[model samples]
Target: MSVVPRVANDSDPDISHVRDRGALRLIACGSVDDGKSTLIGRLLHEAQGVLDDQLAAITRESRRFGTTGEDVDFALLLDGLEAERQQGITIDVAYRFFSTARRAFVVADTPGHAQYTRNMATGASTSELAILLVDARKGLLEQTRRHAAIVALLGIRDVVLAVNKMDLVGWSPERFGEVTAAFRAFAGPLAFRSVIAIPLSARFGDNVAAASPSTPWYGGPTLLDHLETVADEIDIGRGEVLAPPRARPTVTRRFAADLVWMTDHDGLAGGRFLLKTGTTTVPAVITTIADRLDLGTLGRVPADRLGLNAIGRVHVETAVPVAIDSYAENRSTGAFILIDRTTHATAAAGLVIAWLDAARDVHAEASAVAPATRAFVKSQEPLVVWLTGLPGAGKSTIANLVEQRLVKLGHHTMLLDGDNVRQGLNADLGFDVASRAENVRRVAEVARLMTEAGLIVLVALVSPLRADRERAAGLFPPERFMEVLVEASPATCRTRDPKGLYAKAEAGRIANFTGRDQPYEPPLAPALVLPTDEIGPEIAAERLIQAILGRIRQPTASDDASI
Candidate 1:
């Protein structure tokens, strides 16, 4: 193997006649001070991607801000931000365009600081592969695990584990083996298609762009060669196949996605923003927050709202239809940014998981009979009375009484109690915030279907969060839906202990128990506040029936007399 000395102004072939190989997008990421910037700088410098004058300028800047004493600081080539130069750290994602004789590449040098994780996520959002760097001495760090997890979550299947600064570790093959084995073990569950570990000294340019004789035992392809060949494999593997016929951008109102919340403000349901992806932008609203990732276990938990640096699944609805694709298929068309409409700051970056009603070509078969016609035949307007409160708050009892009164009044009605639904429809759900939100969402949808059948639906649920209850109410027109808060203090509910839920929670047998470990937010301005502690269930039911009667088309005096 021959080694190429790191020299400036090495002449190379012109690219005008070279084949037009497509560009490969990749990101460099790891823990802070892991030599990510240096690795990228070396790759550019060795590939002759840096211009002569640009190199000279960094040489001068190196004197003022470089970490290396006398040697030229290659990291200065990518750390262009002033904050980065002063701190000797990368604060933002710096992208550089470089190419070898075989292929062109766009490389993003992402920050490794835990605080700047959101920036790393931004870079990963578009990258097809990841070059994760780790200091030869450190082996692996928490940030390394985090970056790897984010890469896997974002659909990056290819990884190049660059064990940088090999010289500091004496270029010991034993040490390299130890680090490689540890990484492979940790990354086993990340589902990486390939993880190629390469030991290199970015400062001395060993095993980066060319083969170095520093280690005769290391015989794998050099970094550049592997990247170019990887590109070839990606391109050629598909054969000369035509691109799939993309459907015209679906102009839809809503979509479900996985979002990495970047801002400090907590994101709740009903937050409005501008959804921008590719060239299409639309006014959008966060309709619901579903679940967030638990990085430690890599499992999902229910989320009421997304805090800073939180990765959660959410539902977004747009004011107008926009074109989008699944991120799994096309990264460019599938990723989007949500900008705060008020401040214009980016709130989150999201990957499209599924689009709701995005297929403009497919339509629901319209029913032969109209909902209004069905209601007219029933002699009553369809409605949904949503009752939300804490556990043991008498919601079920009142709902049952109201349903009985409605039936006696010669009106059709259906009652959906939360416990009853849990036994069947929501049997798989848990008591976490996300599960509760989904529980409410499913119940709300079912109530809507029932209302369309011309029956008044009564939903009795301990839908804890105000935002979730509001989302449920948003499903119906204001006149068609009534949000009734079953008011009761925690002490009162605990004393009642209708199902011994409070006892289980007090004994630490139940987690995320409403009014205990998890909080319950009552309706802000409910149509009716049934203080179950003050009024009996029958009286409360009567009050609810009277309030609902005002919203529906009641029988006239003459009609009642004939009956």
Candidate 2:
């Protein structure tokens, strides 16, 4: 092996022709018996990567395992595993490194069995281009569709539709065109960088390494020529191929994944599964299933659960925040495997696409007075009692009573109501969803600040969106934050409209009304649910105060308790 050092300005004019190119990683995959292993073995053999002794051994070995007598089974060079030889199939991803005079290549001959789809994904993560072969005699199969879906998920955009075994079908150009056109239509809007279709026979070595005269009708480059020119443009002056540069990869804390369930058990939402990404492993849950892929039609359909071999777009939440990147950005950081806890079996493989709510860039500043120290000084734990509901859901009525009860109990407390807040800090904001979310965010910030000062804060607002409310709850410790939902039907709220906002909204005098025009998303689960129609604010407020008092009871355990 010789290393060529780059020269910025050289005395020899030939130095200007050098435009640096990196090693290309490729994976060959498609339906089983589509000649994936044969194609790879042929490439390595043509490149002269195999040693003389190894070639002799394989030739003899091929005779024993070869289906065709003394034909030198090219698949034998790749299918070296004992099981693979017995089965006469590539069951694992067989990786090989070879170099042409002009380029270096790393090829992963992935298994085409549908059950081993995850293995194809494993190879595609580090690969940039895929050699997706279809048996010209057999056309496209379910395994071909499955491989395409998985390769797309793993972010391999450059594809080569190798219509292999053309000899078996008499090297028919019509068959090749038919398979190619069908694939293009099936993979419409896939947005891969390039899709080069080439007809070749791995068995006959036609178009595998060089252009073949057998296909006089075919006008495109051979399989090797296309693979070497992946960068698209050749610099005649420099004699180098320049691949398009990619944008910078971003670091994110969250992303949606296309999860492939591999185990027999069904994927359960909210179940704690161990997620392993790169070198980091953490507990995670499939928060929600967005949609699943229907392999038959290649269309997305609504689904809540994934069974064995099922694929779905899902939202995953880790127990702790993770520093991740999109699969398109960095495959190592974006690919992950979910493992079942009881069986300890690999359950599913996931590819991260978009990063949501990333916290990697957020840096927390240290405060001089810690919240614990402030609370200790005041002889009470800090708390944020958040009340959410419709406009006239008796939030303020219950809030006022709760404040009075806490005050009577000698607890220092303050009530921050929606109208009062709008009079000052949020006076400029309107009633839109964005403004409402910002409103809740600001309130949560203020409440967090107040709690840090050892004050019990009561927040009463018609914070409609559950997502906004969840954000507010995230601001404080789980035990210190309480979500109280004041339940009132739209009719009850309109009937008890002391502010008369509902009537005005119904009369077209107002816009963005919570119950009249805009909808409110009530909390699915809350610390307390106050049915104002059944009970008065006083009784509800009393129950809330008791809950708060019990929650704020700090542990009195001492380090010297054993003594």
Candidate 3:
């Protein structure tokens, strides 16, 4: 089909006008039957982007497959496939270019089906704004919420809530208000900068490019006008732009990205693959499967492996360095694909979040007084006593007793229990591997700070992962950190079941339960082991107190006076 030239002449005044306003890349997405294709087609038609021949072709095809009787089906212009015309639904990402005297635009008409969500994501990854269409009659559907979530995830701050099919809804002001209000409320935490709700009828072309006389009570810019004037320029700082050497469009070896695993095969961590992004292709390894997106809730969950069609965050270490920016900044340089090394099959599609070695210019400020001075004044050496074991293993009970004993003996002590810490500082975290690691990291940092204050810190947690425990230990010197295992067999812990955790896990009520669904690797050589099954909490606490007291410096009369 023929097309209309965006500008009639090179010297046309509209050329400067379009350039001044800048081009806008946008995507139209929502649930099925939300009129996305029709809206885009009508926008192009009203903007004078469609040629007479193109209109005629669609008009002829509309007679054969149009939803509208005896009228040109605007959706036919974009529903190019035969199956789409027959089904009257979008199934692929259709990009159409259009221009107005005010601006130029490239709008992607993405599928609204749940199965084609990945296709919608592809379109959204490069868009500056999203026109989230919703059927005025249907209001907000699940797919509508899903698309909105994806739009926010991809970092499109501006959203146009196009409530289409207003004619069917009688252009009711109350209905429009309800849909708009529901969307704003649902999108509150999604972090959208703007949500402009435009009531329109895509099939009838009301409130699309021109203000519809049918909705005289409604006062808002036509969808086209809003699109023509929306500002998309972001203030990317000099350091934010230059700090990522890997973000450079050059080749890099290592980077971190958010990806959707597509293949049936599970992508295990440390597996070798081919990293293909932009113009570069290099051998790569997924060094870590950082986390997977729980799409149902849009939360990050810990994942060691990526399954079919799983959205995951991962770190890729390449054979060489690559030049790419965070996907939020530069879509062209940030998007990538992971291919199997042997089969050469595309395993996943990824968007760069950052380089593993992304540089930071900030420096840490040291205190005037040293930790040694604080310890000497307090007459006690700072130490972190980490107690790790399975649930119901008496770790918390033993830790509480030990801390109480130490306090009575005139020692400064801080006891950090798992449940208490989770309720406050780590409340936002989940039980996923990544969250657990973060949980351990936060506790370890806090423990380190407490040590600087010359206090004995007791951390009682079911730190299931040995790696996480070891990383926490790395924060302190050999003498300053002690790993204590509160040992109890799974059977013994279950019998105790103080919190009913084991029973819940056995009944499949809890997921990722350590010693049941998830693994718990005990410390190879703990400083002390209290077999809780063989000894009482009091006995265990006494043993722990003796061990801690032996390691710490004894208080002197001069040290006491200084404090």
Candidate 4:
């Protein structure tokens, strides 16, 4: 384990790689000088997992600068850097792939140095199980507590406390219990799924890959045995335990996340940054940093800002809403890092727990034009001229003529007829009541767009339902939405039907036919009521234009329920 390893596994399988089995992501992390490299290297070496070429290289490297002078430096297998070898400590995360007979494992060996805490956070972000190593002689260090807090903060419910170098402490079960109890008391509130303690001498291979007869009283599966069979562990973390797959969340988007501030710059409520959540990167800003948790004291205090290594629940706003699963459900996409746009530095890391407010973020995704631009362009107020009536009521004919007159007068306009729009924009919509309501909704949104472009949009629709019409009207400003009802008795419309729609509806070819099988609710407070049976389309068009001009040019007190 060198780098952060993502785990994927569904269920345990037989102790042979002959068949496809689940895999687990195990990350070895603890305080600096906690023997994280030796433990990982020891596990691989004892299992005879290294290739001959890799083993030859490690043997050569160990002779050059061995941690235990001329002795096998298992740490050399992971510490690839010359500086790391000279210092006898891991600097970078070592990522490697290894497998047992029954189950495969993706291991991450992370640095234990205090300055590299951010590195450790990266490693454990996607890990299903964390191996928090402790020096048997030294017991748990401050870094141990810090790593535990981070594991909990990242929402990894499964934990394993590896008491390394048990040989140094004379293999005292009492000492192991003492350290385990101390950590349990401190980590009880962190809400891990389970925390199992294991005693091992990584240097001597006590209980890492195989059991030791020296500790006969200790009766449990060895490290390798537990990896093969850990109950309740599944492939849900990454969904493919064979290899570390990129984290993908299903359906859910928008998140309330807990972040670990890693940059030197202090956080501000409105500062914008780029967020990296699995394969997706998006623009984001911190809405607020409510409190900072002191890892040493484990206390929450008021906070306006976060310095380096500060853990806080930051309210985040994204430019585009993303589909994400909860961190508890899928750790892959749920974890994220904040990047500084200017410097490309990692500013923070976060885990999403829930979805939150989206109105501001939605507005942020599109450009909002000032009313001056669109409304002032044509020297006329941009509006939706809603032409609502039953089938064959001359709504489209009058609406088309009104648009032609407005266009001829140098006023920009767009005519949206119900039949024409249904053929394209709403082709999937049926004549069901719900679909009809949605049809009106889509038309209203289009009209709103036209108004934003400073064009008078004449929407000729059956809009038979009063509630649907009202819903469409509410999308625009009261001064900008004018309702025109084209009235005619069903019998009179049937006789004068230009398209013969009433004939087809009457023949029972159309099922949910409005004004026949379905209901037609007339507008109660229309700006104008044009009786198409009494007046011709040309006269109706002229009257509709005059009614709209009065409202667009200068709405007067005399303009009441009828024009």
TM-scores, all candidates, are 0.60, 0.62, 0.56, 0.60
In candidate 4, which residue ranges exceed 4 Å CA deviation?
Answer: 1-21, 231-255, 358-563
lDDT of 1 by residue, 199-247 (tens): 9988888999888788788988888888988733232121112233443
Give the winner by lDDT.
1
lDDT for position 284 in model 3:
67
Sorted on TM-score, best first, the list reads 2, 1, 4, 3
- Candidate 3 residue lDDT tens string, 397-509: 99999988999898899999999999999999888666776688789889999999989999999999776776677668889999999999999998999999888888988
Sorted on lDDT, best first, the list reads: 1, 3, 2, 4
User: Which scores higher on TM-score, 2 or 4?
Assistant: 2
Q: How close is candidate 4 to the true structure, as a TM-score?
A: 0.60
Error of 1 at 295 (Å): 11
Clashes of each: 1, 1, 12, 16
Mind giving the per-residue lDDT tens digits that candidate 4 earns over 33-108? Answer: 7788988888888767788898888878888877667667788888888898898888887876677777677678
Residue 503, candidate 2: C-alpha displacement in angstroms: 43
Q: What is the lDDT of candidate 1?
A: 0.81
- RMSD of candidate 1 to the true fold? 11.4
Runs in model 3 with CA error above 4 Å? 1-21, 232-252, 263-272, 304-310, 329-332, 340-347, 355-563
Give the C-alpha miss distance for residue 162 in model 2, angstroms. Answer: 0.7
| lDDT score for candidate 4 against the true structure | 0.76
Task: Tell how far residue 199 is off in model 3, in angstroms.
Answer: 1.1
